[model samples]
Target: MQVSNRIAIAWPLATTAMHERVDALRQGGEDVIDLSIAISHFPAPLPVRQAVAAALREPRLPYTAVGGAPELRAALAAKLRGENGIAATPAHVIATNGAKQAVYEALYVMTDPGERVIVLRPHWPAYAATARLLGLETVLVDQPDVIDAAFLATLPAARVLVVNNPHNPTGKVLTAGELAAVRDWLRATGTACLVDESYEKLVFDAVHLSLAACPDWEALGIVTVFSASQSHAMMGWRAGFAVAPQAWVSAMSTLQGPITAAVPALTQVAAAAAFGIGAVSELLADYRVRRDMVVALFAPVAWAAVAAPAAGPYLWCDIRALTFDTQGFAELLLQRYRVALMPGEALGCPGFIRIGFIADDEATLRRGVGAIITLGDSMARAAGGHACSA
Candidate 1:
């Protein structure tokens, strides 16, 4: 059997690879402390669960339109306009099965083959995969906590400029001034700015401003993709939407029809309710406590350090001081210490490792950090290393 070249070019995701390693370690009687995946440690909000329950109790099990129920889109549109100051109507919003699917649809609708799109790194891995799958070329750029204006000017005019704020894995957020600059810069070059605010609700210590709010932004192609999956802790609910110009929304609606129909009616209803509640904030506070606790364990040691994430639930740490690459340290720690973390290379940052700050109990998280430090010290000492130099 023959598979396509796109599938062949894809790098198997690091998170899934770690899961297989974890299973092997577990069968060997090792106790594992997991920090690999990004699943929220909290349950869905009460209203959302109730909505799903209500829908499940119904007899229809019927299909919704490809763009989802009008009620959910209206609720989302109202929230976008009233709160975020983004000019979106129900006509410009579509609820797909999940945020990931929404992203894929937008990319497909907006892209022509071989078009160049700028994807800022250390990013979620899927962004690159999606580009490759569509035969679209991705120009990988690095904005280490937002680059200087001079450096950004060097890029060629692009078809689209992609960014993930309140970022995944690294959990960094771009400031308002920076966002405005990107909007202006991209618009001037005729590049559509696709600002992914999937982690928008995860912003803990900063304000998140959208490119859509920039002057004449809609006319210049500013698109924002979002989901209740992250905001409402509703991953399984698979409820997501994209906000853009009416034309783009119409394209997305058509593309999503057979690809991934509208999200379940109950999920969309619950997502509408999610917009009115603070379940996301309350849950973030809990995760923040875990983040602080985990960082505290590494704080005492000078050899290892965690750059406190501005948002979401991850700790992206530089571990190259102990080894040549992050995977060396991650693998040794996993084999001996039984703690799993995402290597930064997977997120496009070499020599760093990422730990999900809220994946485990506070006690377990603390212990895992300690194990990493201890194991790292030994490895660095034995290898005549860099990271564990105390």
Candidate 2:
């Protein structure tokens, strides 16, 4: 049997593929330290676990509405209004398996196959991959240090713009001014917006602001997606939801029904519990320490430049001085040093790599960093020796 032409050209997401490779090696008894993706060392918050426990005690779990149980939707609406400053109601909300589903459905409902979608460079892989799968043209622009009106003016008009707050890998949180500029640009261009706030609760120094928090969100056609995977350390739970106009939510729900009906009942329960708990201070504190430690470790190394991010669990390291073929560097590091990390090529920027410092214990994290430095130093030395001999 032959695969469909659409999927035949596509490969597994680089981030997930690398993590799976590490898993395979570990299962074979190899000691591989994985920093391929952000998988928190901490477990889900106490309340979420407790909520799932209580739900399990019920006699039976029945199917609810396609979007979510009424109660769950209502609770999520409250979360949007209170925490995110987005005025939402149950009709404006739809529960999803995770943020990825929300993103796919939003793009599907918001644009036609031939329409264009604007994505910033060094984006989460799914944004481009999903757009491609939908047969939509993806316009990738280099993300600027600041997103002001002048910068937004340079972008071409498109059907949709994807925004990631407390962004992945880089952890650049959009400032209020930047968000206002984007909102104005959307209003001016008549382009819809999809904002992913999966890392909202992981902010270290900067504040995470929702793009759709303004009064004109509904008119602007902005859909905001949230996930408990990173915020609550509920990666396996796959609990997430989206806030959109009622009609868009209805359309997304119609689409979600056939693909994967309402999110699991227990997940809805866990989501409600997780979102209601607000910021997880303890988790934030731990991640901050780890982030600083990794940044400090890379400071003395001349070949790598790693900075402390204001938010999120990953550290972005630039090693262009050593080599631009980060894909090969990552592969060799995994094979020879038994450590795994995400190459910047996967995130649309070569000569860089993303290191997730939130997964293993302190010792393991230190060891992984040491291995990376050792490999990079060796490569630098070999290059120097070759140059002198020539």
Q: Cα RMSD to native, each candidate?
A: 2.3, 2.5
Residue 243, candidate 2: alpha-carbon lDDT: 97
lDDT of each: 0.77, 0.92
TM-score per candidate, chains pooled: 0.92, 0.98
Q: Which stretches of model 2 miss by more than 4 angstroms?
A: 385-390
lDDT score, candidate 1, position 204: 73
Query: Could you tell me how far off, in angstroms, the CA of residue 69 lies in candidate 2 after the best superposition?
Result: 0.7
Error of 2 at 372 (Å): 0.5
> What local lDDT score does residue 251 receive in model 1, on the 0 to 100 scale?
93
Clashes of each: 3, 0
* RMSD of candidate 1 to true structure, Å: 2.3
Candidate 2 collision pairs: none
